[model samples]
Target chain A: MANGSGEVVRNRQVIFRDYVSGSPEETDMEVRESALELRVPEGSNGVLVRNLYLSCDPYMRIRMRKLDVPSYRESFQPGSPIIGYGVARVLESGHPNFKKGDLIWGITGWEEYSLITEPETCFKIEHIDVPLSYYTGLLGMPGMTAYVGFFKVCSPKKGETVFISAASGAVGQLVGQFAKLVGCYVVGSAGSKEKVDLLKNKFGFDDAFNYKEELDLDATLKRYFPEGIDIYFENVGGKMLDAVLLNMKLRGRIAACGMISQYNLEQPEGICNLMNLILKQVRMEGFVVSDYYHLYLKFLETVLPQIKEGKIVYVEDIAKGLENGPAALVGLFSGHNVGKQVIMVSRE
Target chain B: MANGSGEVVRNRQVIFRDYVSGSPEETDMEVRESALELRVPEGSNGVLVRNLYLSCDPYMRIRMRKLDVPSYRESFQPGSPIIGYGVARVLESGHPNFKKGDLIWGITGWEEYSLITEPETCFKIEHIDVPLSYYTGLLGMPGMTAYVGFFKVCSPKKGETVFISAASGAVGQLVGQFAKLVGCYVVGSAGSKEKVDLLKNKFGFDDAFNYKEELDLDATLKRYFPEGIDIYFENVGGKMLDAVLLNMKLRGRIAACGMISQYNLEQPEGICNLMNLILKQVRMEGFVVSDYYHLYLKFLETVLPQIKEGKIVYVEDIAKGLENGPAALVGLFSGHNVGKQVIMVSRE
Candidate 1:
């Protein structure tokens, strides 16, 4: 149905209900209709964006909680549209830089059409040759996270041994490729055999292992990293983190990206091998990609050409329509999504 | 009781019995009186040194345990004389570098006299105008530890805020002084009120607190470092380390020297604030003083002049004779010492 003021017709979105505890159920979100216009009013200093792809990241799980606990970003409040990074096209803009038909990627709402007032953080997609969907993943937050965490945080040198956890995921896959580009011996661990194969065959990681099959993580790490790990990009925390700590070499560097394992847990497991940090003289650092936004142009310069030349490859797990968005997002916890989990909300 | 022959008396050291669990008792060491000798064997490539002052450190407690825990240095074998850094006068030497009556410091036994075979690790104390006993404390391992851990490891910059734990101990006192020398706003935590005063009065620490008296360590750190901590020299781990982690500023650095609280306990406390590292982009590193041992001569050059001018001060809790050595050594865990704990086996 059309709006009373003669605006284009649109469906109102249902925001996720209050913060979820334990594993989030599909029932957490409720679809509610709203009497709102999708188009920006005349002289309004707002950009009306139609989100094409919404990124489902592990960091979002932290935001769903009530309190700010062990997270870089602020927690999401109840009865609000959960905010995340998304790839959107400007349908109408009252701002100068952004115009109709311009593709932009940055912070947007989880709904179909978002009225963005603070357009300072948004960036126009100058290079449109690549798939527009890549903006949701490989060319966006996940890509930057991999770049900064691996190169800037770890300071990896040539011939250094690198280990990446969740190596077939959006961020982990890019980290593995970056390490390989820098001439590092890279090894990765994934939850399934298919992801393990993807790490080795698709991303070009030196070695890959299915953590599901490996009963002893310590022994598995010892087998892969015989000389010990020089750089560890920690994505999945808990037991994997504990195992990686034991495998770190002298003066090793750890870039703490995300702790996917402990996100759903009531009480995270204790890591005992932390004393090894002192013995090995290791350096452990944790960082957020948002903090390194200033380096976006520099990162683009390094990563863009590689993508154009087919030197860098990316994979995505896309779900069609807003109807399937909830299922696609919830699939992440179970390692159901193969790569970057993206929801295609609309083409318009 | 002098031998008819012109010979030097030597005592074969009492060895600390194989690793003991829990608190070590005097029964752990067996002193064999029959090991005493009155002569230096002819044509031996070894120095007969009369032991003087022996330095006992908390790290020795870890070495005393036979378990194969990861340590920068190897553990002391059971039925072996527990070796520690000590100052002694060489009565006779077959090595050309060390001559008779030359004062030196290196790994030595907890006995009256010992035959030093490997003299390469030992350094001759040429400038012995001051008390030679100082070599076992201020001029020895503990001094190098404070110097390197603060200057080299943490890389403190002027006008930066620095926080140190165990501020009045062997290494912490010197670290505080060094931070003060580098123009850093230095704050320190000690086990007692007296040591806290010593940090402010003697060591020139900018602020001091008795951790035992402070109800909330996080509040104490916040009070001291209103601008937040730029550098944290971690000596005591567990709750103190966790609190420091929370109060760290953006891009802050933490140098982990020791975790005395966790060493004795069977179960170390879990750290829950690691997410702060991610938010602040903080770097936490662990290092051993031995890793930077090559800077010894350079360290002596910088620290000696400071000592001579009384710009750098050192204090020691000395126990006369080997009889009270056990109690003095054990005093570290209980915070019984004011500064460096040194056991005097004999007078020069």
Candidate 2:
């Protein structure tokens, strides 16, 4: 396949090598060259996208494994281009939902060009006043997840104490902002001092803590949430979740969005204090953003104005080029990057 | 002061010797005598009552231990009269909700006589056609818990598969019946063959299993619930919960009522398959009946008619006297009781 001008160009893709058990490494995926198909196939209902920004989310880690348990989404097939959320510009289309030059964000390959057969899956970028990279972080899947998890699942009440784990990341940062928007007292936990500072200073969290530095998570939770946690937006599960369970107030709600810490582990840790749920009459709910995608338009309406007003902010960590996609994704587990991590594939 | 006739009697009381750890023993409590002044005090809106039926619930075990974590309810005070739910005949009343000879059920001392300052806490028994002991099991706290936990928390729909742990116990029995009432296919797990037989033959469960006899609980659950459990009425929450978590269907709901197994353990068992929640989009919620007391009337309305029509039945394992209350309550831990464990103190 070649460009419309009949000149050959290379498409570099990050391909999954094999299923992994523990922490995934950059070497687990290989950067390979593929035929550049610059145009949508003739008589084919597909949109040819030049991928711009690829999202490096924690959920991707789970996809890299040979999922023995049932999951909302499928694992990445071995020896295939690792699929993830990305921002792209349509170069050609045979689908009615999209056409040439339409900017969109949805599931795409970790590569330069993707022939998206189902263009309807991608949302059209009507509001582009913000940075185009924002589509991969604040305006896309992560944004909607934070929206539904905090507002829909947790069901925030004004003046409630909201605690978000992994609080400096893409979804957590948005949840913290949303909690504050609803007049909640918000606290966050991040892994490093840099991420901790980002949570408190940049995101305006009521309190922030570096979980790694805190020797006693339970005591740390007590310090930040003296009264008790009304809502806990769970990201990193395992011990953090166990500690949070101990701190939850009567009738508290847990929005279990991700269990990143346990995802790569051979065994997910025992969450003791679960009896606290019955004692406090708490509600712990796990949700997937895909289940609530119909509310995307509503979420955009709620978040866009706040983003425009500067009341809500999003910070992104950018990795240049598709060659670095594996490292960018692997970085999420180590907390190497602050805020949302996205790999830059192409300017267009 | 006496029961309207002005006679004083000795009140035999079960007092907590000290805060216990792990499974509570009969020696942890002392059956002693107290002054039985069965009369409402002057200037007090309290009700004086002669206890009749004392309930021996699994939750009583949690109350015996000194809770290191903050709990919704307080632990039993050392050297104080052990409190429990009971049916009583009011000897005197300074509260408008009660009067002499009024039969009521709620929190009471594990003694022959008790002065209840909060008269409003007791529910006045209007229907007495059922065995009076039934008030301690079917018509009282356990009944309400089963009703709220199964119906309110689980939100059952017809044809859903329901599983209950501790199936022959107070709450589990009612949950199974409630599932059947809702047109759900119900399965339950109990410890003994007797209880298992009761669950299937007597209580109309679609199937029942003796969990103690099963080598692999997960396999047993799969055998019972071939499709998958849509609702799990969680009563025993250690290894059983871990197994149930694996067998839950997509969008399944777990109503966490009690964790009798974990309550005694220094460490609650590691619930390994919690990732299944994200995988199946299951919702696990814990509840206390006190929160849903407002629904008691609604529950009774739904249950009483069924009881009258012979569509529902209740079984009570009665401990004949208050002197045996300690053993009766302790028996719950060993799965000795084949049905709802109740201590019969007085018939009237």
Candidate 3:
């Protein structure tokens, strides 16, 4: 590739077909190739980046739906490249925040090269000793989300009880680890036996259960937390939340992250045990990590050292090429990936 | 009646028949005569008090239901006196906190005399200037509940928008006034037109509506709070809470005081828009005033002046005697009483 107006590359992208219902299938997306220039637009505060790693998250499923009111995220445009968090290298820059050859991570197009007009949204990657893909999981949006949601929103204290749903996924795994670090009694629920074993043996969750296998969520929660739950990191909504309400201790906290189970449903399941909120004096709050993005530098300072010292661990399930992007993105809902789902697009 | 060891008074009492499934009817209770000794029980720390006023509250309805697990308030036992907040005068004392002729307000039996074992629960009434009946409504449990739930739990700020449900009742009316005093734009909803009028015209609420007349609660809330609600003092739950959830602004606070609407339902209404909490970064918390009982002294100091200076006002709907107690207690469920429903058991 040459660094001039004449130089162009075939930028392939996974395009969202249309709005979907139930679970998204791989065929709902189509791979298409478009032309891309190697340089950022002239006289604009934009950075042209070569995309490396793409993050697969449950929240993207919400972005695929049409909303009646203004939401925190916009619906994905039909026949356009799906947008998500990615690690990239700056090929050209018209922005003061970044220089050519600098590595950065932020929201980007699911293509080989992207002209990021919102240059300020991306953060410059300082530490390189760890895998660059770490930005997609441990140091990126999902990691920051788990950190802020647990510590800031939930206000967890040492020796408190913590519960996580979708426990082996990107955010849940880190939350479990973070709760363990804070000396809390952590329990998590996942869909498969492998994920459950991973939570207990690998992630150090005090107890783990397969939600699919459990016939009674309330009884299962009672079995795991005999005293009652103090902090519930809500990832799966519907019946799981209903059970959690009954099992929450007095003055418990619920950090609503994502409701993977109900996002695709035409109408969300009704939460029946809400009156328990009044009985137990519980607080159910929801938060988006973008609100606490200012804490990213501080988060990196704490997490990078832990990662370097082997005090913290992050696992990634990587897909090796751009064509497999659709399957990876759609697979989040089905729990196909073991850990943080990342698609490796290019090499450094 | 003589002042001797065997001397007794005819104690006319209202006794709960059994656990009720629906709204408690007048027939659900039976009035019968029991013997009350003029003196406190010997060899026990009990104070004999002559009952004066009994409070009829929404929480009492919960006590009439059989539960799967033990709740804060136990189910009313068959053939036992209905337990509630009451104003009484100490006839005899085996406890140091009270002596003979001391007027107090606390949990007492619905009969002529009560042997109060836990004297610490009673607060000695110092001033007789205010109506003694106020201890059952404005000066007692409901008043403290409103103060703590609004100021402490809601953490309201001036210029914020506030919405209260069941707005003409004991706690709601006071909360509306408190919001007004704090420079908040307050709107309230009640079941009857008279109650709505009482809220806006008498209680100083900025706006009021009859929820019974409003077909679409969500649309009504939007009309009342065009900019969205910043603080919601939840009293009547079910549909009202569900509507309030949709109208809550970013960083909104919901203080769950009581849920009069859902108390009689076999299965409580499901709250579907809880996901809004995460999208708007809202905090919905449930609390019981007993947790903040330590603030009682401070509450009286703050409220007494307001009442004396005519900065705040309270209304009471009193039934003349213990014979009318069953009707007053049952009337609470039917929205029959105009204000705080109190049974005037005896004159001060």
Q: iRMS of each prediction in angstroms?
A: 2.1, 1.2, 1.1
DockQ of 3: 0.76
Weakest 10 consecutive residues of candidate 3 chain B by summed lDDT: B1-10
Candidate 1 chain A lowest-lDDT run of ten: A1-10
Q: Which stretches of candidate 3 lie over 4 Å from their true place?
A: A1-6, B1-6
| Interface DockQ of each model | 0.55, 0.76, 0.76
Score candidate 3 by lDDT. 0.89
Any runs in candidate 2 off by more than 4 Å, and if so which? Answer: A1-8, B1-5, B68-70
* Deviation in Å, model 2, residue A295 alpha carbon: 1.4
Q: Per-residue CA lDDT of candidate 3, range B1-348, in tens?
A: 113474678888888899899778889898899877677666767788889999999999888888666556678888999989999998888887788899999999888778888889889998789989888888899999999999998998999999999888999999999999999999999889899889988999999999889999999999999889999999988888899989999889999888888888888888888888877788889898888878888988999999999988998999988889889988887789898999999885
Q: Which stretches of candidate 1 lie over 4 Å from their true place?
A: A1-11, A14-16, A33-46, A67-71, A94-97, B1-8, B12-14, B33-48, B67-71, B92-97, B213-228
Which has the better DockQ: candidate 1, or candidate 3? 3
TM-score of each: 0.90, 0.97, 0.96
On residues A58-92, what C-alpha lDDT tens digit does candidate 3 reach at each position? 99998888866566788999988899999999988
Per-residue alpha-carbon lDDT of candidate 1 for residues B178-287, written as tens digits (9 for 90 to 100): 99888999989999889988999988998899999988988888788877899999887888988887799888899888888777766667776666676678888888
**What CA RMSD would candidate 1 show?**
4.0
The residue pairs in collision within model 1 are none
The fraction of correct interface contacts reproduced by each prediction comes to 0.66, 0.81, 0.81
- First chain TM-score for all predictions: 0.95, 0.96, 0.98
Give, for candidate 2 chain A, the lowest lDDT window spanning 10 residues: A1-10
